[model samples]
Target: MNEIAVKSNPRRQRLLQRVRMEIHAELEAARLQLQQRADYHPTWDYFLNLLMRPLAPDRLQAEVGPSGETFMQFGTV
Candidate 1:
């Protein structure tokens, strides 16, 4: 059996963290703006829930190809 070790890049990790924080901040701002609308509807809560849901995985998975090359699998945000 062959064992594959997945290594994470520090730079990429930091970048991802920054991006996630920015996204969350933007979502919160949008949510607040929507709530302040004069005609806010309860049905909009469903959409807000979807927007507030987790956008992406904290860490990406590294897969080894048949040729022994490792690549990252980025998840949807």
Candidate 2:
């Protein structure tokens, strides 16, 4: 059927509503899964990473270029 005929039909409208509800349910389920992932806790290895420091924090330097843009330079050289 043509677009206008399908759109005006009650059966077509019902079918569209059913498909819409199914897609909405899938979207909601996906959102709930993402929400659960967001609430997840990190492992012990994550905390262990915080205890380690850079090998040469003092060697890090920050300076502005001719264009007035700041950038970092690592190492004494």
Candidate 3:
């Protein structure tokens, strides 16, 4: 396991989670723009919310789950 995984430090974990969400948002935004979808805002908005959400002790990583009301679903939920 990685050192981060082994130690499970709360502060480091929160920082990692924040960085991960940012990356997800960035990649999803790029993909949506690449696909040339007209209505990418709400999807973009969703990832933005994910990026801004506060860290919870029992936080779960984003997944490729079934989509929300938005037409285009991201690979990372």
Candidate 4:
């Protein structure tokens, strides 16, 4: 099938490529920021513990099951 080819102008092609590159760079930057935010939560907790010791509460106790003899630890680190 020898279909007639539609020629793309070089200037437009360059412009499109430039736009795509910019979008890709922005996406990568956003991904990095999200990763940093995800990792910050745990470290933030540790820092709060160190900086706000008196404000923090102690560990909690959980109710036992039907056996009524099994207690479980329940609280954030």
Residue 3's lDDT in candidate 4: 28
Best by lDDT: 1
Ranking by lDDT: 1, 3, 2, 4
Question: lDDT values of the candidates?
Answer: 0.70, 0.53, 0.57, 0.52
Over 1-77, each residue of candidate 3 has an lDDT whose tens digit, in order, gives 25566566887777788888787677667655644766555556666555444233233554344464433334564
Which candidate wins on TM-score?
1
In candidate 2, where is summed lDDT lowest over 10 consecutive residues?
50-59
Compute the lDDT for candidate 4: 0.52
TM-score per model over all chains:
0.54, 0.41, 0.38, 0.39
Write candidate 4's Cα lDDT for 1-77 as tens digits. Answer: 12223346666666657776776666556545654774566545555443333222322334455587765764568
lDDT of 2 by residue, 1-77 (tens): 35537567887777777776776566556545654775555563343333321222222356465589986655575
Q: Give per-candidate clash totals.
A: 0, 0, 0, 0
RMSD of each: 12.3, 19.3, 9.0, 20.1
The total of clashing pairs for model 4 equals 0
Rank the models by TM-score, top first. 1, 2, 4, 3
Error of 1 at 51 (Å): 2.7
Give one digit per residue, the lDDT tens place, for model 1 in 1-77. Answer: 01213237666667767888898888888899998899999899988875675443433456565589986666666
lDDT of 3 at 32: 59
